[model samples]
Target: MCTLLWQWFSEVELNSGELYLYHNSGTARRAINSNKIFGIGTPRYHFFNNLFWTESWWGNLCSDPPNWIGDYNVYVRRGESPLWDTQKNQAQAAGIDLHGRWAEGEISPYRDADEEDFRLMEKSPALDAGADAARLDGSPAGNTMACLFGIRLLRYGPGGSGRGPRRRDPGRLRARALRWPARE
Candidate 1:
């Protein structure tokens, strides 16, 4: 599943199933699940260009260890003592939120979140803040806006491919391409 531009008003939790270790009576065996967030499911989940903010002191953002990959996200907490460290440590271990920024006043990435407008403003931290999508799962880089636009243009404009547009070069994400990692 490809998720983008999502805003979570409450805490977010991820399930990674369970893990088991097997070893021989006298031999050593190593079991590693580097790219499996669930430890038993396909590595097909991705999150990008999302914002998370909460006013409660206990609100948190979490994800299962290992597997899941993401970037270009934001997390903010509003309280006397914000537990930003906990949020940062957890995400870093999961290869996600590598470039995610933290803020207190800039809670929303849109011009005005209360007005139901998710469009990023010129000075919004998320305007050009995103990671390379292909690195996560062979997806295009950038925020949800660029992604949605690319999809629409590729599918219904010029020569519609139905399956999505194909080109000699897949090209990198545009518009909100600021700080995007160089294409490989």
Candidate 2:
């Protein structure tokens, strides 16, 4: 789950382990067997860039809501509602992913996720959709910009243009929580 990329056509289940960069056509479910993290009232799960066709069901009915970090992602469902419908209010209340959106099929960020080409297309909603992590710090050192794994690195500055690939580890993910501005 470090810097690689993919798209899925099935459900992603996180029963009692960690998953990264995997795609699933079904709901991502987590069992409620009383893990230390869940028992203590906070779950430190991190989900990024992955797509889901259904709700990220957490621990059936008995388990408490999960505390996870999710951002810079898209969620869409056909017909009446999305996978997160049942947990919509709860999830939002807990701030699961205030940044995610109910994207339409045509607005999908990927050029063709069905064909496994996950690159963001022109006018993609996902362009710069991630949290502006580098801007959190107010000092000169904190003024740096970052382009995380898999996404095209675009640098804009005086007489400057640079691009590269970078992976985000837990150490790098511990910065202050910030929300992306709302889109029109």
Candidate 3:
């Protein structure tokens, strides 16, 4: 079972769409059903975690995004209680030890998304202020969005055949039970 889960993890891709780890939000040992999210393409790992941010996402927003990417982004978020000159002021902090929130321990994909609603995306201005905000084309952003996503790594179950790492349903509260010591 552990081997299946491991194999699944090793094969997850980040180009399909919204990926999800089969099982509840707490189930650890599970599979990635690429057909669950949008159900268009084969249920494959398409999303990755966002590994770019200054402040910790766990503490700040407590979210897990697919594909940990580097985001040099800029977005327009409606500011509230404009105490500062800009609404994006306190909302855009960066560079935090997400390890404490996400990579700190084992977590089921379901629980992560359920708690946060899977709405974590990076923001960037797509354009500079002095770069002709009218028709000014925006610059490319590095992955600066602050989030930690858990992508569907593999798909192995009744739905797929040799499609992903073969893993049994680790069911709820099983994430902690999975004890596969790193192979020597």
Candidate 4:
């Protein structure tokens, strides 16, 4: 978040009264956003992927949530919202609707692929890597290790610390734990 903010501050000229003062976004905020360093991209408009990511003239959080919740304690409070949400929602409630230039999915940072690129993905070998038709119907043809590993990788990604209360592994599958045999 700091990277983005710093980038904004550097790019956008602030006047004397508008000198960027670091302060919480609320009346009783204990502290400002979390100290997380949000990696920010350079100032450029990319229509394909980064279309939705842009800043407003008078910096708004909903436009870009600074802390991602860790830094914004209001989000943790009862019925309270993150400052970003508060900025957006309050503006909305006050009948001042703000709309971005691009919708969520349309404008992308990645280059807009031409017709050939779209066609190529369909003919890509990776999509056709399954074993000969026999295995498609659920019969065991071989280990198909690559496919199994890919599936597992997508499904069971480690979210947090590997060592702690929330640890998990392949052996501790939900079904296996439920069907575990009673103590002998």
Candidate 4 lDDT: 0.24
Give candidate 1 regions above 4 Å deviation.
Answer: 1-43, 53-66, 76-83, 132-146, 149-184
Can you write out model 1's per-residue Cα lDDT over 1-184, one digit (the tens) per residue? 2122123312344323221111100101111224322223323233355544444212212233444344565544544344456655766765655766655674444566668675555555444445444453355654443332121233445675444323222123322322322233
lDDT of 2 by residue, 1-184 (tens): 1112112412423233222321222223431112333233324345544444333334432345565555445554433444346655565777765766545453555568789886556655544454544432232343343323322234547754432223345334434333322344
Clashing residue pairs in candidate 4 are 1-38, 34-71, 47-108, 48-107, 48-108, 49-108, 49-109, 50-108, 50-109
For each candidate, give its TM-score against the true structure. Answer: 0.41, 0.45, 0.19, 0.16
Worst 10 residues of 2 by lDDT: 1-10
Clashes of each: 0, 4, 46, 9
Per-residue lDDT tens digits of candidate 4, residues 41-152?
2111111101112222124233333421111011112123244444546434433222211112233222224432322133222222212312223344543332211111
Q: How much does candidate 1 score in TM-score?
A: 0.41
Encode model 3's per-residue lDDT on 109-178: one tens digit a residue.
2213457653322222121211111111132333222222334454556775535443323111111111
Can you list the residue pairs that collide in candidate 2? 10-24, 10-25, 10-26, 11-26
Ranking by TM-score, best first? 2, 1, 3, 4
User: For residue 31, what is the lDDT in candidate 4?
Assistant: 22
What's model 3's overall lDDT? Answer: 0.25
- Candidate 1 whole-model C-alpha lDDT, 0 to 1: 0.39
Best by lDDT: 2
> RMSD per prediction, one decimal?
16.3, 13.7, 19.1, 22.1
> How accurate locally is residue 57 in candidate 3, as Cα lDDT from 0 to 100?
22
What TM-score, to 2 decimals, does candidate 2 have?
0.45
| lDDT value, residue 145 of candidate 1 | 34
lDDT of 1 at 54: 44
Error of 3 at 71 (Å): 1.5
